[model samples]
Target: MTWVKLFLGSLAVSLSLVATAASMPDGCNCFCVIAGRNTTVDGSVMLAHNEDDSGEMMLNMYAVPRLNGNNAYLWGEFPGTSVCDHFLNEWGVAIASDGCPSREDREDVTDGGVLYEVRLTVAQRAHSAREAVKIIGHLVETRGYQASGRTYVIADPHEGWICSVVKGRHWVAKRIADDEVMALPNNYIIDEVNLADTLNCYGARDVETYARERGWYDPERDGRFSFKKAYCDPYYYTYEHNVIRQLCAQQYLTGRNDLVPDPDTLPFAVRPNRKIGLADLMQIMQCHGENSEHKFVYKRERPWNHPVGICTDVTVLSAIFQLRADRPREVGCVMWVCAGRPCTEHYIPWYLGISRTPDCWRRYASAAQAVKDHFTAVEHKRDQWPHHIYWKGVDRWASYATDWHNGIAAVQQARDKRQAKACKAFAKMDKKLQKYYDPRTLQVKDREAMVKSINAFTEKLYR
Candidate 1:
């Protein structure tokens, strides 16, 4: 016997890599970044995200008040995870996304498609970011993209867009140019296209003849058809975990020593080497690829056998937003959250002219019972998460990612002494609520003292 058939083919390739790493899916390891408004330092068209989902999820927030006629916005809920919800509206626009997994395994959809109404129909009907990339290419070319592709990014207060959806009715979009800087992962970082450049691209008009009738493109051995190299999903888009988190967010936004991790020599947007902010998008969304030789093994019950960072260990939440247009688009559209893993918490900020977001950060009292309990992937309960702030950031990020090098310098010295006292109480609460509003009809000139001074400085930075 040929050595008992090589020990039963090495025990059936170690039980099919432990049944494909225990059937991986706590929502595709998300990450995103955008900059644009002249590449940041507060001219603000910035965007940032990292909502890496994992089990027992529940983190909601709603201010959603323009019911059925849509757009009153400020929802972030993640109930039943249809593309891990996020938004911001009242015409400052804003949205977030990252799970890009396309190479369309053709569901060619009609109805069970359009996962969670494509960023809530571009935050209830776009107000800009070029009408949210034409409402995500007309809801993925008329109700098509159900899943296995998504990108979104969309912004306002002077533009920023990304929109890379594909899983059926093809898509593409791009526009981060007011002096560039984009970083994204979870795949599809939109590559070369021009639906004849209608002011910097938009999607599908047979998107390269349907990727050359599904041979996934071959413009003579693929010379120019680059929708992320012919519609990504090349085994998780050539993973080294989305190429070392988009080369650790363009080497922390361009201090770049010749960036690598070669997804065809990366650069779907760059220009930084200076002016980016919100503490460099919260230190590159609390990066862990810190000078990569690779070794931050945050497995958290086998989150795809480790090695995926731009902060992981199921980065429950982390945002940045900050979409300013030099003043009152209702208090310059802030977001800056963290309810966990911005390297173990502390971000807080909120404000898009708040009117309520501190009933211990809510949990479904109606947005139609949280979109009828969305896709129902329930877990979050344990006595309603010890009265909430997203379960104290999922209990201090499951004890600081279970020993992230001896508790990351005491969670970055108590999250940098509460991010320098909540950014000096948000610059004295934006100079005392921009004199109770009227920086040209952002209206509020004393709407109950600007919603009681933004609900008492967002409940005094969530206590």
Candidate 2:
């Protein structure tokens, strides 16, 4: 089924679907905050993501080994998939993506490449944001992008890049200005491509030629070739949900009340009025367009007219990558991940240096085990299955929050308190660990102990 249909159908059954569907939801949302060295509270670059998927799936983490002396990285992985949806390497490079459906003329049905493989290759090999962009362009040019178009957000400690892929072998990537912040809501955000600006723009050699041949662009009539206008699916471009989500994100980031919700004129990236911080990015990720016309209501009677919020029933995980170039590689990358709905769940910090993932965040040992745990068998009576502890905890909160009438505010407040406490505890622990030991030299046992402690603390917070 098409993503649009899947998204709408999921919304219709959102309240009724149980925690058994392991598939990712149709559409996703994400953003990146590129804080020039001075545009942040602590002068640190930050990238935040809301990985909206079929809320039923199990979320897992893996520590990918370094390849030929390349940096090792930690990424969120699923049971049956090879793609790393969200990842951070030892070099402080982070990558996240949202699927962007393309117009029929721009679809690349011949490309034998998968979207996840592109993301994984870039995450594993690229050392910087710009390099990641070039890698994506090269992959598409040679292997072809097989899936629907997608927008990838790649960032390092200094800057961010948005690489949007069209079907087949054409793509374009643009760098987010050092002082700008960008929010992507499952649609192409690059308006125009500047081939001459090698420092900031990268694209296939036939990007414009292909569009012109297809009658999607005209040099004489159209001032310049727009990647989004030429490639984006018309339905997605005019869809109210996409437009509202983009506008809401832009308004929140710029703090502008007068801006209108028009996709054609929306800036690809904007400079924030003040330095952006981790907390600000977190709040934006959780935004539901509340108290505004674009607010997303979860009532069965109300049709799905707006974009899903940061805490939708379909969101499996949300993460923020805190990368600091000032710190050593061992202590520089921190991924704050919330395994369930962002509204009721607290983000727990996982250091990039950690060698092991707690059992609660690990995937099932085998496919049989996965089926038994999530589908066929019911070992835990109260939760209906013997899923991982993390999932059990998520289900507990979701039961209440999904009610929407009485449980939202209370869950939101409690989650906020828990997250704040966890953040503070993480800061203290990270400081202590970095002060005495280099993460690179830490023994496996030491890493395991740290992970256990953090996992234990997370369980306590939920309890």
Candidate 3:
């Protein structure tokens, strides 16, 4: 383990101090669900994510068709933004994250700290979830993390890892057990750091010593070294709205109303009473927290200022990754992506082997252009949104939210009908397609033919 031993100005990270990230609200949060293979009905590792953000944001989905040399992947892109992107590569590895603010305020960054480049490197370079975590550790330790903090939920076919990062050179990652499920909000949920458990953990070597040196921790007073307790901001960690969203998922799986909204009280991960399915996980991600034991009074006009609940008024997009090892990665990995809010838009299946995404998904500028435009470009205005799929769902969601309870029924009815059709179409496509690829080498026997079929099927779903 190569641990970079550079410590900048030492200042005690105050529990009272608040953290701010690049162009995001303090209350903003994203929800991610990691279901280990043994906990799911089909025994496939499931990772579900809802990208909660507001503004005239745009989402673009495109496949990087360079699998021969570099890795090919389906990039879930948010143009002109640093932290709000997701990816699924050719190896069945998928990555998404929540902006979990930490207590580290020291400016230890080199090259403006690593932000957008972190996830992109994982997508382009990593061969497995473990490799992805190692890549993140190297980048953060050497370059430093740019955001307040973030917990990246990365998973491959066989397992899932929740990699929690601080604002500086300290970080930790833990693997989810096969029988457990983890639901993460904006707060840091990884409390126990067992770096000795090398098989299930990977992190900085001086994670505890650095905190102690900075006066952030004292083993005499704090007992064992809790990375989360020493580094996470108390205000953000216990923020009512975000933790409630985490509890909502817990409630559904445990069927227990007594589960508290606090992270300390709630189990780090819950064992579901029964095996979970795609639909069950979908319902969990779509929750508005209406049925939970605790209720929230809408502080702003927008629900969670339009970004709370597992679902939200400001959710630009959502993804449910069904990652399996039973077959070749091309046929094994699939992302059920919804353009906008889960409540308003239907989730369309996007297979990993597809040659290309629909034109509507690629109407934005190229990948290199988007990265350059991340900080320089102006936000797109509302009226301009109707031209693309992401904004169309945003516009539709905003309209339905006017009537809310009354307006949601008809829209959901039509969306469900379309959703059922998509599921049926995907089933037929998978059955016809799975046999053509070799599972041993993760290669397709007939790449061009399979690509053609995938593109045609994806086009039908888009239309």
RMSD of each: 22.3, 7.5, 5.1
User: Which candidate model has the greater TM-score, 1 or 3?
Assistant: 3
lDDT of 1 at 174: 88
Write one digit per residue (lDDT tens) for candidate 3, span 1-463: 2222121211121121122224345365678999999999888999999887755677778887554245778888776555678899988899998888888888787755677677877887789999999989998998788667899999999999999998889899999999999999888888778899999999999998998998878999988887777888887777777778888898898888789877677778889999998888878888888669776554556542333477877677889999988877777899999888887778888889886778777544464444334343345533544466666676677777777777677888998898888888888998889667876775678988888888889998778
Ten-residue stretch with the least lDDT total in model 2: 1-10
TM-score of each: 0.33, 0.81, 0.90
Rank list by lDDT = 3, 1, 2
Q: How well is each residue in 1-463 modelled by candidate 2, as lDDT tens digits? A: 1221212322222223232222224343443334444566767777887766542455667666565445677767644332326778866788987767787444443323445456656666788888888878876776577555778888888887889987788889988777777777767879988989998899998889989988888988887889899888876675555666777767877778766667788788777888878888777777777624665433343222223564455666788887776655545667888776666677887777765556555554442343223223322432542455656765565576546656667777888898889888877776765544455544233555555554455445445
| Model 2: per-residue Cα lDDT at residue 370 | 38
lDDT of 2: 0.66
- lDDT against true structure, model 1: 0.74
Error of 1 at 391 (Å): 34
Poorest lDDT segment (10 consecutive residues) of candidate 1: 14-23
**Candidate 3 local Cα displacement, residue 54, angstroms:** 1.9
Query: On lDDT, who's better, 2 or 3?
Result: 3
Q: Model 3, 353: alpha-carbon shift in Å?
A: 0.6
